[model samples]
Target: MAENQGFIGSIVETVKTVFWALVIAGIFRTLFFQPFWIPSGSMKDTLLIGDFLFVNKMAYGYSYASCPAIRIERIGIDLGPDDFCGWFEDRDGRLFGSEPERGDIVVFRHPVTGRDFIKRLIGLPGDRIQMKDGLLHINDTPVEIEDAGIFAEVMAPQGPLGLRPQCANGAVGEGATCEKEKAIETLPNGVSHSILNIGRRSADNTGVFTVPADQFFFVGDNRDNSTDSRFPQAAGGVGFVDRKDLVGRADRVMFSSAGRSMLAFWTWRSDRYFKALE
Candidate 1:
């Protein structure tokens, strides 16, 4: 009976600890820092294929509830049929000091499915955004580009997600579909940054779209490889996101990984960690 009582006491303590730990995390993630993982190369060669990142939930503002579309969790509840009611209730509204600015790297909930997405802000309300021949234009003005040298491939030495460094023969299976070009982009505000253009095949390179009030346009640096505001994915609509869908601006690159290969640890580059996004 004594031994049994000891085991039960340990189990009870463990459960209580776990419960409180989760409670604290829920409070933090809901109103403070939230973690995110990159699962695709859609944002490469900037974000790469396997970068684990933390999205600042409070960078735009803190919340005690949830964004409307996602509401993946409410307070501390996991999303489920029974949790839907809470999702709509007690939504943690924004605590922003100001609206998101142009050129701010942002994390936003996909308007189509309420999923989170990180992209560069390119257009704002009352702006005319058009893609011409693989170039971005805003308000009938073309975004200027200055030639920058090719981006050197950086190697990732270690991470839970093993990514091999970029190489001539790196396992980017769809290499044929990607094109790399180096350029310095200057937005209207003179916010300039180096950009890698994947190819000139982006579907966005043809038409004009007017950003609606309280909406913004965004794109990935990988151009053709990104399915951003260009395609009509059933899960996410094509082009433009409302201010409400935007969660927070991407402040920095945090860290990037090569890909899924253990032999490539030597390929890791230490210089790129925590680099500013733009």
Candidate 2:
């Protein structure tokens, strides 16, 4: 009887340990940092398609309680089944957290779909943004950009979703190749990054966009391919994202793997491990 009781005690201790471990981990992820995987190449060359990174929640400052709620919903928990828990809760402007810089790579909840999105902050509150002949203009002044050269990618016939439009122009008799013009762009704040231009794409030209107070304007490094602040929410693009929708800033690439499964260790891109984002 004593032996059986000892075995039961061991099981209970193990369960308790695991329960506490999960609780601590959940708290850390919710209040401190969160891991995210790159599933697309929208920010390519800066953040690759398979790069995994941690977003520093403390970068801007502490967000409201809705931040935790958003994390919970991501794990399939239906907290409220109402507007309050749908990642659309209104957070006061006076709430904790500092404003994001003009060129920081930010992850936020999309205002329309409540989905998480990561992009480079182009315009801060009250900044005038525009695009002309594939160039970005801020406050009626053109952002500096220099010709970097060509960026090429291997594509299947079907091709990657957003990359197709650019690839279509660079297809060499068809079989599976794509290319785009690359440029080194400098934001007003002196943050320089790489941008992919797809010749004369539709988003390459647009009217001026005046960022509102308590909101931000963002865009992808892959200029022609990203559906960002340039498009409306109803058009499947993230419109002006509110300050409360901001999540955190991506700090570094922890590891990367091009394989579909984690077991495919051979596909790991070891060179990209621990790469810091600019």
Candidate 3:
């Protein structure tokens, strides 16, 4: 009888440990940092598909959008930020709110879709943003861009989505070298980052976009590939994102995998571990 009682006691202890661990993890995720996985190459070279990082939630303070969106398709569980913090919605501003700097890489919720998107903050409120001849223009002045040679990668399936990259050298078979024109673009704030180009498209030229108050403009580093603020939301683009939808800033890449599954140890990119983002 004593042995059976001890076994039961062990089970109780295990359950208690797990319960406390989960409670701590939930609080940590909610109040501090939120883990984000890179599922696209829109910010290629700077942030790649399969890159994992934690968003600094405290950077811009808290808002209704700061609440986590838990979606586990396998278990049929789907919850959005609105479900968690909807009571906080339609508020004027964030609690302990801080303004985001220009040229910072930001993750924000889509104003219309509530989907999360990561991009470089380009235009602030009331800033004029435009693209001309495949160059970024801010306030009627073109940003400085210098050639940085070609960014090449294998023309194979990337990440879990199996999405192949678009190449500047036209279509190529799998295992072939895919290339894009790389350039170092300097934002008006003097923040410089690498930008990739896959030839010119409709996004390369646009009429002046006058950002409204409390709204900001964002663009992808992979210029031609990203559907960012340059396009209208009705037309399938992010349009102008509101300040209240800002989630957090991604400061570093915790891990990165080139394969479809992050558990595939051989496919891990060791160099990207704990790499600081610019």
Candidate 4:
């Protein structure tokens, strides 16, 4: 009887430990924060592949993951990736406190594939958004573009860098290129970034859609590479993010994998560290 009781006690303790761990993980995954990885070049020059981002689940509050099933109640729902990614749950009833603002970088779930994506907010509801000659126009206002010199992508004839070049100075992420093959465009909002407008390589998208209520229109900073609302939702895009599906407002890029990882310490890039998701 004593041995049996001891065995039972051990089992109970293990169960308790597991329960607490799961509860903590669930809470972290649902209410406070969640982790995401960049898997595509759709948002290149902004977010590279292998970059990990911490999604602020609290930003869009009342996470749909907290709800066990379809609930009749309305307030204080718990939403996790499951609901945000549209895996198990069909719809989450979370409402609005503040809508996604223009020029805000956001990570929303894809409408068609139900995958998470990150992009910049360009147009708001009731705004006329159009792309002309590869330039973005909001309400017919041409966003200002300033050329911050030319930007050239350098390949080490390999990955990010196989050997630290002689010109490698000013620490990592500070950039050491004296020449680039592209030009950087800074918008009127003081948001400056680079785009690879190689040739008249055809953006292949031209249309205008009204931003629906409680929804937002997004585009990638790497306008040419990003697969955003510019394309129809049928083309595996992050179409008009619904309020309920707004997983979180991207506050900051806590960290990012510098796209290339090598065993040689010199190959490790310290850039994109603690970068804000602007």
Candidate 5:
């Protein structure tokens, strides 16, 4: 009987320990940081499809409750930007936090779809933004762009020929094609980073967009492939992201793998492990 009692006690203790550990972990995630997986090639070489990174919540102070979900029970008077569905008028406000600087990569809740999105901040509130012939223009001054040579891989080709991934060594690989234009773009604030241009697309040339107060303009480094503030929400773009929608800033890549499944250890990209995000 004593032995059985000891075994039961051990099980209970293990359960209690796990429960408390999870609780502590959840608290830490909610307040300090959160892990995010890169599932798309939108960020491209800057951030790969399998990269896992942590967003610093303390960077912009903590939101009321981390903007838990898309739908929130309206607890107070409705705020403006009425087009956003399931938006929290009261709980949407951010707590103590600094404003996002230009060239910083930000993660936020998409106003129209309520889905989370990560993109680079290009235009701040009241900044004029436009794209002309595949180049970024801010406040009517053109940003500098320097060609960085070719990056040999075109992912998710629009045509039906499937993939034709190119390697730097003139070798062809399956499920990949290397035929992209890479360039280094310098923001007005002197923050320089790499951008990929996969030929001119519809968003390459757009009219002037004057960002409104308490809002921001964001674009992806993958200029032609991204659907960002360059397009309006009505047209399946993010439109102007509200300040209240800001989540946190991504700082670094904790780990990365090449394939869809992390369990595929052979596909692990050791070089990308603990890689710092520029």
Candidate 6:
């Protein structure tokens, strides 16, 4: 009887330990930081398709959007931030919130889709933004850009989505080199970062865009490949994102993998481990 009781006590302790561990993890993810995986190449060389980083939720303070959205298709569980913090959704601003800086890489929720998106904050509220002749213009003055050679990658499927990269060198056989023109772009705030250009398209030239109050403008680092503020939300683009939708800032890439699965240890890119973002 004593042996059976001991076995039962061990099972109870194990359950208790797991319950506490989950509680702690939930708190950490909700209040401090949240893990974000890059599933698209919109950010490109700056943030690759398989890069993994933690968003600093405390940086901009908590809000309805700060709550994590859990979606598990296999188990049929889908919960958004609004579902968990619906009361906070009606609030005007964030709790202890601060304004985001221009040129900062930010992760925000799509105003229409409620989906998370990571992009560089290009324009502040009431800022005039436009893309003229492939150059970024803020308040009628164009940002500086210097040629930075070429960015090349293998012409193969990337990430789990199996998305093929668009190349500046035009179409090539699989496994061939795919290239894009790279340049160092300096924002008005003096923040400099690399941008990849895959030739000109409609997004290269756009009329002036006046950002609305309490709204922010974002753009992808891969200039030609990005469908950012330059396009309207009705056109399937991320129009002006609201301030309340801001999630957090991604400071560094904790890990990166080139393979379809992150568990593919051999596909890990050791050079990007803990690499600080500019």
Query: Better model by lDDT, 1 or 3?
Result: 3
Please write out the lDDT profile of model 4 over residues 1-278, one tens digit for every residue.
99999999999999999999988886666666777666655555566555667777665555343222222335865443565444534654564345556766677766656456778777776777777777777777767765654434443332333322111122334344523224455554566665544333355336666787767788876565667887777666666776655666666555555435535455444676677654
Candidate 5 RMSD to the real structure? 6.6
**Per-residue lDDT of candidate 1, residues 63-101 (tens digit):** 322332234344764452124334433343455646677
Q: Distance from true position, residue 23, model 6, in Å?
A: 1.3
Candidate 3 regions exceeding 4 Å error are 1-12
What's the CA RMSD of model 1 in angstroms?
Answer: 5.5
lDDT of 5 by residue, 211-266 (tens): 99989999998786677999999989999988877778998898887665788788
> C-alpha displacement of 216 in model 5, angstroms?
1.0
**Segments in model 5 whose C-alpha atoms lie over 4 Å from true places:** 1-11, 64-93, 154-176
lDDT of 2 by residue, 113-202 (tens): 666788999999899999999889999999999999888765532212323335535546544557778889999889999998776778
User: Rank order by lDDT, top first?
Assistant: 3, 6, 2, 5, 1, 4
**Candidate 5 global TM-score:** 0.82
Q: Better model by lDDT, 2 or 5?
A: 2
The candidate maximizing TM-score is: 6
What is the C-alpha lDDT profile of model 6 across 148-183, one tens digit per residue? 999999999999889899999999889999999999
Model 4 alpha-carbon miss at residue 106, Å: 1.0
Clashing pairs in 3: none
Sort all candidates by TM-score, best to worst. 6, 3, 2, 5, 1, 4
Q: How close is candidate 2 to the true structure, as a TM-score?
A: 0.86
Q: Judge candidate 6 at residue 257 and give its lDDT.
A: 93
Q: Between candidates 4 and 5, which one is better according to lDDT?
A: 5
Residue 209 shift from truth in candidate 2, angstroms: 0.8
TM-score of 6: 0.96
